[model samples]
Target: MGRIQMLNSYIDNLTMLQSLNLIDQAVSDGKHIHHSVVNAGKIVLMQKDVQLRESVNSADIINPDGQAVIWASKLLGRPLKERVAGIDLMENLVELAHQKGYKIYCLGAKEQVVSKVIEKYKQNYSKDIIAGYRNGYFSKEEEPGIAKDIAESGAQILFVAISSPKKENFLYDNRQALKSVNFIMGVGGSFDVVSGLVKRAPEWMQNIGLEWFYRFIQEPRRMWKRYLIGNSKFIFLTFKEKFKNKP
Candidate 1:
């Protein structure tokens, strides 16, 4: 996989299988790989959020999580191979954990949501694949302790499903405490989908880059600002970058 700069961020141009292979290699070699995925909204936010930029940019593997991001990359003359959606990556990693006899720790989502995810994972894969789990409802002071617990849980893979910036910061801040974990990733809202609390867009919508709209329609009041405003800003920024980079 190669890393390319686009839209003021770095994205690893990797297919889903490539990403899974890299993670598997890291885990097998007992090395640490901090993973992150960037979408249109996050790229726009990172323009003004220095910490978020640092946290995401510093990751060992950064994937394009939004189809809009893929389109923007092409517009800017740096086309990506595919969009590696966070939920899809998480699902593949869970299977990887099962196949490789690795354990994963799930941290994020509501209490019932995370619980249901763990239960479902146990049902789908074996319960042995779960190292530990906790709801994403801790305070700032609890962050260190939570990281410590995951580190000691014998988990080879760690997935944080909390919201952006917060999840990014938590993993960045506690990187030292979680040093033993072989792979670390931020999987926003993945638990909700896994727990059947949310529905994913159809394949055609995803292929056409309307997955965000599908989500927005599900809860317009909650997602209008995120999708509508955020996407507009992203489009503006992408064009701005394209002009700025002109030779």
Candidate 2:
């Protein structure tokens, strides 16, 4: 019998290539794919949030979406080799979708942001594989019809850029209705980055895991709370785990 893994503790880290390969397999097999990321900090925080934990753990592909996760993997001597940022994965998937002639459905970002993202994709790809796109803001009551439209559009891949638990919950709730889709990725804020609404960190900043600082500097008012508070809590929890030897 297959062993039952600990949802709270087990780190299923994957590099960019490994993640891309899984996406390829899922697309080829016509299987619904749900994916999320978990770092050392998120793992411990998720222990208390059962629904969030279950949703992430249930993902068909779970990547180490943060640098802290890559660091932890190396410390554990089972290094993931690289970080697979969600934004990069989304771009890679778009390339694959265009090459494979797969229709894509994009859902998330503000209305204008979504429009700009679609326009950018068209400009870059020029092959017309994007079946449709919708802004992130929608009444819960309208979700059923929206899902139906996407399924009928014959879109093979669906990219959900709605932030965090919302995107995760959407996938968990609508996996059945998304039957027409073979790949569904929860890509938070990737659309904004791709559409040039937000700037990405420089190579040096990203390499040293100071990307958050770069963002904080760019939009201090909006990001101060997230980076200053959320990041500090994340660091504290990571150290807590280290002292506890949870890994």
Candidate 3:
């Protein structure tokens, strides 16, 4: 496995297809895998969030979810093959689960969104492939129980779509309780994308790393600071690392 360090986190140097293949191998061999993803916002946050940094770096897979991350890796002397975006990974994994008869449990999004995703799977894939599902809202006290429920659901794959740090820490804290789950990943906002509540950026924009701008256009008030400030911070951090590495 190839990896490159960027600021406070390390990202797997994996293409989307390679990631899917690794996931398939993990499921087939019955190995437990805890997957994590990082973009600019996440990496910036990780610099000050010790637990976030640990949880992310400790995962079996840490994919670069933002195209900017791929560019940073390249500029800093560790060029990743490509961006393994989270939404894309989730979609591919869902299809993989369908074709392979692997059970999946989706945890996140509102009830309606998650329901739609589950229903989509039911319509397109084997009906029995959905082990169970629950929305992302829950009291902090309820986390352990939810983890237990997902563990007992007999799901081969678990996709969690809650917000950052929370989703990552939840999986990290309860990984012991989720031993029955073969592959677990925190897919932020992927449920909304899959359920058609939000449209992904067009391919050309995504290729040029303007996906954030597109998302900002969709929900400007909500996403502006995240993308604008977060992207700038990421660039600074990358250059900081780049200069630090110069001999």
Candidate 4:
């Protein structure tokens, strides 16, 4: 797995299947792997958020979660293999856990959303695949306890569906407390999509990299600045880096 810099963040240039295999191997070996995925918005935020940058870059595996990221990599003369979306990867990992009989701990999202995701998983797979679950609400002081609980859950894999920075920071800060968990990754809004609270973009839209537009239309007021402004900033940064690296 080659790790390259894209928009100031390191991304692993691996296909979806390759990423899954790496994670499965780590889980099988009882080794800890902190996984993360970065999209356009997250990378734009990371440019100024030093802590967020550290948390995400420190991960053992970082995949390109946005097609924009793949395009950006190409523009910078560092073409990535493919986009390994967080949601898609989570869905695959859930199936992997079921096949391998590896328990998983679900964290983040609202109580109803997380519970619904767990229910869906149990319905689609088996109840034995679930080790434990918790909503994404907690005080700063409560983080250690939550990490301790997940660590002791006998879960070989952990999926956290919280928002950025928080999820990244939480996993990085409490990594020691979560050492018992073999594979940990932040899934962003995957719980919402899995629980049927949010609809995912169609395959065509996702392929063309307009998934962000699909999300923006759903909650324009909430996502306008994130998609519109953040995307513009990302474009500028990508171009600047491209020119700076030109021979």
Model 3 TM-score (2 dp): 0.97
TM-score, candidate number 1: 0.98
Compose the digit string of candidate 3's lDDT tens values, residues 149-243: 99898899999999998999989999899988999999999889888999989999999999999999999999989999989999998899889
lDDT of 2 at 13: 55
Residue-wise C-alpha lDDT for candidate 1, range 1-247, written one tens digit per residue: 6889976688999999999999999999999999999999999899999999999999999999999999999998899999999999999999989898999999999999999999999999999999999999999999988999999999999999999999999999999999999999999999999999999999999999999999999999999999999999999998998898568
Angstrom error of the Cα, residue 68, model 3: value is 0.5
The segments of candidate 1 whose C-alpha lies over 4 angstroms from its true place after superposition are 245-247
Single out the weakest 10-residue window by summed lDDT for candidate 2: 1-10
Stretches of candidate 2 off by over 4 Å are 1-10, 39-45, 76-78, 245-247
Distance (Å) between predicted and true CA of 69, model 4? 0.3
Runs with alpha carbons beyond 4 Å of true place in candidate 3 = 245-247
- How many angstroms is residue 95 displaced in model 1 relative to the true structure, after the best TM-score fit? 0.8
Cα lDDT of candidate 2 equals 0.77
* lDDT tens readout by residue for model 4, 1-27: 899987769999999999999999999
Any runs in candidate 4 off by more than 4 Å, and if so which? 245-247
